[model samples]
Target: MTIHRIVCAANRKRFTGQIVLGIRHWDLFMSEALDSEGDPVDQGFVDNRGNFLLRIEAWKVAEAAGQIIRRVGGDDTNGGTLYSENLY
Candidate 1:
């Protein structure tokens, strides 16, 4: 989380907020919610109820962080050039 914060601070034009997903949670989700081909099941995102619930929680946290950023005048409307640097 701290690393993400620093990176986002350095590249504010791209990132807004970060959500830390644990490896165990991700593994559990992949083991249960995905098909053998690594694709989502017929139910898609909600194939695993636990993972879906955690995803919703993370989304809400990020949304709240975005609202706080907007209130503090840190929105994405700064009109700065985001891709001015050349890609290697």
Candidate 2:
């Protein structure tokens, strides 16, 4: 279960600020979640019109995603403002 965490940031001035965090299985699901050229899905977070911040691995995808969400804006009290999605 090679899990990979991806962090994405979207900043469009102060009107709209968004951070997207997600997880996917590298070995089992990455290929399916990505396109033929080894890129994330067309609708995947990374492909969205935003800044791709980071990608990491963890034992638990959810936990790792949460951590990435927390470190996004120097605080973790934004509740569910950080959107999340699973590629698989």
Candidate 3:
């Protein structure tokens, strides 16, 4: 199993999330969950309102992180650019 950390930045707020999945099966899982349209759902964003963290599983951290980066309006250039790294 492999775990990947994905961060979500929204409304000037930032949150830390993670994903866990099998290395071999990540392609199938990611393909189904992500595509050109984006994530299958907005659960990650919704869950960010509380103490929840968006957890996902993928074969590659970069890929999973990419999905998250796209969803949060951060592209390759601005991905993970947190305004405040220390909020907790």
Candidate 4:
């Protein structure tokens, strides 16, 4: 379990709160419950199954995607950007 300090969108207050980690749905509902991580919260945000909502690390998510993209010939590095302009 990890504690994350965050602000609430409903009331806009800052507070420290406990976050439940090691849950399966942590990745799925993270964005949804992230707004309630601050002070003035009456209860911990959770789903019907008691899974806490938290944010996923961006780098970790990117790293996982990179592995999959590489396997499918989706490497963006190999592709070059082209800037087009109309010459009048």
lDDT of each: 0.25, 0.32, 0.29, 0.29
Candidate 4 regions exceeding 4 Å error are 1-14, 26-56, 61-88
TM-scores, all models, native as reference? 0.19, 0.20, 0.18, 0.18
Candidate 4 backbone overlaps, count: 1
Instruction: Give the Å shift of residue 65 in candidate 3.
Output: 5.7
By TM-score, who's the top model here? Answer: 2
Model 3 residue 41 lDDT score: 30
**Candidate numbers, best TM-score first, in rank order:** 2, 1, 4, 3
What shift in Å separates residue 18 of candidate 2 from its native position after superposition?
Answer: 18
- Model 2 lDDT tens row, 1-88: 5444534322121222323233532333443333344323222234232344332222133345444433343123333223333322
What tens-digit string does per-residue lDDT give for candidate 3 at 14-38? 2323332212222455344333433
- Screening candidate 3 with a backbone cut-off below 3 angstroms (N, C-alpha, C), the clashing residue pairs are 18-55, 19-56, 20-56
lDDT of 1 by residue, 4-43 (tens): 1101101001132222222333355434433344333221
Task: List the pairs of residues colliding in candidate 1.
Answer: none
Candidates 2 and 4 compared: the better one by lDDT is: 2
lDDT tens readout by residue for model 4, 35-56: 5444453222232334432222
Rate residue 36 of model 4 by lDDT.
47
Model 2, position 37, has a per-residue lDDT of: 41
